[model samples]
Target: MSRLRFLAVPAAALLLLSACGDDDAGGTTSPATAAPTSPAPDAPGTTDASTGPATVALSDDGTHLVSAEGRSLYLFTSDQGTTSACGSGCLENWPPLVAA
Candidate 1:
């Protein structure tokens, strides 16, 4: 009887230790959590690809553009040409001109 009892005690302890090591992968970020709250600064002379067709504060020849957040300015090389590539889903917070 004592021999059976000793074996049972060790077996129960091993079972208990094996059950304690479960860890799930890191949690995923939701859309709301991943979304950016502020717009990124645009370089001068370079058009904001994310803005709309409405007029932006570019120079007479479109050499520079300002960010909507008013945090920084962006510039584009004269050879780069005018117009921005930012459109569609990229303009959530950085909305383009609205014909005011």
Candidate 2:
């Protein structure tokens, strides 16, 4: 019984040490796959996903207007939300169909 106890203690220690040995049997972990993120929310009075110049709305007088940032459109307006009177000078600062 005393000899068995001596053997048991050493065996248990060896078993524990063997279990904790450096074993890289498992392959390296590849990076986790992440889902594609959608575009961020639009700012106040802005639009998204409409890149470049696209005619958004027609002027009351039937003049064509281009949208800015495909979201926030700038047009010649005598009143609010109007796009009819943007002169060449104004268009220079806010070019129509300009890249973002």
TM-score of each: 0.25, 0.26
Tens-place lDDT per residue, model 2, 11-75, is 99999999999776543432222223333233333344345223343333333332322234443
Backbone clashes in each candidate structure, one number apiece? 15, 3
In model 2, which regions exceed 4 Å deviation?
Answer: 29-100
Query: What tens digits encode model 1's per-residue C-alpha lDDT throughout 1-38?
Result: 99999999999999998888654333322211112223
lDDT of 2: 0.44
RMSD of 2: 19.8
* Model 2 residue 92 CA deviation in Å: 60
The global Cα lDDT (0 to 1) of model 1 is 0.42
How much does candidate 2 score in TM-score? 0.26
